[model samples]
Target: MSRRARWLAGACASTVAVGLLVTGGALATPPQEDSDRSARTEVAVGAYLHYGSPGVERMRELSRWLGGTELRAGHTYLPGDTWSNIEGAPDSLRSWARWRKAKADRLFVLNVPMLEHNEAGVPDGRVAELIGSGAEGEYDHHFRRLAERLVALGVPDTVIVLGWEMNGFNYTHRCRPDPENWQRYWRRIVAAMRSVEGQRFRFDFAPNRGGDAIAWTRCYPGDDVVDIIGMDSYDQPPGSTFREQVTQPYGLQHQVDFAKAHHKLISYPEWGLFRNGDNPDYMRRMLVWIAEHKPLYHSITDYCPHGVWQCTKNPRSARVFRELLSAK
Candidate 1:
């Protein structure tokens, strides 16, 4: 079968492919001008940080370290300690925005509270209810509020990957097989964000490529609705070669194939080095992959270090971390 044919078949919905071919190109931006006045696109490297404690201090250092190099952007959780409603969520977000504005040109969010608040593992009743209620507008409204705040805080259009890796089975709705619900929620959010920001914000539909061609095909939110085809994968130490660990399930080209097929950009938003086997050498190998393929728009490692005030403490990972920040 033809590629498009296969895509359509796997999606099990023709509207998805049709929506992809039309309507802003598969969760696409509203045709922003890629003029020279705008900054050229480049990959970023940063880490995920929760607000409070050492996050504030470590973020300061991370930004400082990356500022001296070619690092393009940073990714952080939303409501970054500046904006707060109840627990000061909005306040936190605004704070992070201010912090980011001073250093990085762009920032990406992996998940948002709107989705997290209602997240139930795959087949969650709430997910079913959202889909069942057919209230795409309600779901979209929540995301729009978040996006609006991001814009209000001065985050540019080219940063921000809303709901990254929502398709993976690990998070809420572990592989929620209903493409329509996912598509509806996704498109509604994208549409709401665009209505506010226009083409100023870039969006990403991230998923874990587990060699489940069906997984990619099954949950694809149509082609036109996505701006970037992203994957999150990693190779822990002590098991296989770094090359084998990182590349086996989904290699760089696999990502490229998905991007080419969908006409989206590429990125590996969340990845890291776990304690699998070879120790420091494995970390070096992972860095080699980043250097060699340059596959990510900007990369982030899992750097929380499992305790308060403990970031940048993983010595094995820190070596690669310093090297990546230093690489211009």
Candidate 2:
């Protein structure tokens, strides 16, 4: 059976951490001009919102509350969902991008899932069939179309996080059980999207932190096709202190080392409090770590159970988040 299917049949422990630690002290400001590509850190803050109801207004409110611009929107798009309805026109992803752009020159970290959202029940043979043999044509067609649509919608520079967290055993796109096909699939998608005329999109290869299910590096599709190495880290697997989290094998330090070796920028497309909730020290340590290591961008998943906004769940952590993010 596929990993996702087995996961659906039974519950398993959560084992992912996606925090991007900033190097040095304080968040570095971006260079004045686009051409000034100096060796400096630029940390962009953002969040994943609950769809439809709160909308971008909540993000704006959070920005005001935090005293900074939430410049990136960490949005996810499953295969058959709104943003990636490959069968339909690009209205959904386009409208969402336009909404985000209307707020600011915002960067969209779009998590594009390879499999359909309801794939948890899918048999392993069917999953393999979908990803293998002649599937490149479908991937190329939809991905190029999506790229063209994003360019048309004024978001040509969108960061496409394809099949994120593939190392985890729970997702339909898990790299294990078939790493060769997974890597090939990633390369094909990248090639298809890049082939679009005037497309300047960046592809991010992100996986959950730690060697929980599989070593993420085993699925590395090469630095040539990947622009950023991202991790979806949170305070997971419980009881590990912040220091232990980063120092663990296939942890933050390993991710950083891998990115440095490949000459790529690091990113945390998703992160927040989890497993052990309401831990303000985790919040403080994470912010300090981000300020010290200096990642390209990171976003907190703000919603019930894992959210910091609304304050009902994690008030202390929320306060710490605001204070640290507001600092100059």
Candidate 3:
């Protein structure tokens, strides 16, 4: 799209007036879609880490468990996969990217590590290292290198999610407590990567379910900087019934609405059900609801290191997850 078309399309697509009212006494007429209006928020499917060698066997099982249907969609993950083999980091990421591009019909996401995190050897006190004294220069170079590699692999700019959950307190990379440094580092990363790949890769910024509100209010890096707005959400733990999980979609909607408000696309870059893996029948229902209601969620990443550590330990939960990923 040309610069002018991109501008017009974004403006029209976002301005979905709730109920346009006229003083001329006419009925509340809805705004019309102009020629430039875009219907771009369609759901895409995929696993999180589909490329697995012996070094990444567990992740491979997670992806294969998701099955062929899921793999054909795409996958996303940060560089540090539990610090197991940091030496294979670049090659691992590249291997996964190559698998998704070659095997999947739609390679939806390629997540890059953006912030300093405990997983990446950044100590908690290193928040100060973000933008002070040129410490971020090294991080900037890393991101630039990854962006270049992805573009070279035939992944579009939009398919890349630069950072995954910035505000959640759980992950080591979560930048919630350091908003200013996070914002500064983010701007530099975006600028540097764009210089290398241009618009071929659509930059995505994902925050935890409610993290978007905090990140957006603190900074406005311009709509051009972000192509898709993303949220990472999951269902209630295993003790609950399928109906309980059904209600969880509403929380996901909050993320979608927030994205719509900003004229950006929404995606569930990460999501899965816990403890429920044993009930394939009910789990299938949950997947259907996820696909039907969370239409804006372009990718569903059911695979993560945490899934092994936290979710799939129980045999029943593993069954539920298999049903979900294998849902046809």
Listing every candidate in turn, what is its Cα RMSD in Å to the true structure after a full C-alpha superposition?
12.6, 7.4, 11.6
Q: How close is candidate 3 to the true structure, as a TM-score?
A: 0.62
Q: Point out the worst 10-residue segment of candidate 3 by lDDT.
A: 1-10
lDDT of 1: 0.48
lDDT of 2 by residue, 198-262 (tens): 88888889998888678999999888899999988888762267776777889888998899999
Off by over 4 Å in 1: 1-41, 52-56, 63-71, 79-88, 108-110, 113-126, 132-135, 156-158, 173-175, 197-199, 209-214, 236-240, 245-252, 275-278, 302-314
Off by over 4 Å in 2: 1-41, 51-54, 68-92, 99-105, 134-138
**Distance (Å) between predicted and true CA of 314, model 3?**
6.4
Off by over 4 Å in 3: 1-42, 49-70, 81-89, 103-105, 120-125, 131-138, 156-158, 170-172, 197-199, 211-222, 236-250, 275-289, 293-328
lDDT of the candidates, in the order given: 0.48, 0.66, 0.48
The best candidate in terms of TM-score: 2
CA shift of 54, model 1, Å = 5.6
Candidate 2 displacement at residue 232 in angstroms? 0.3
Please write out the lDDT profile of model 1 over residues 17-36, one tens digit for every residue: 11211211123222223321
Measured on C-alpha atoms, candidate 3 has an lDDT of 0.48
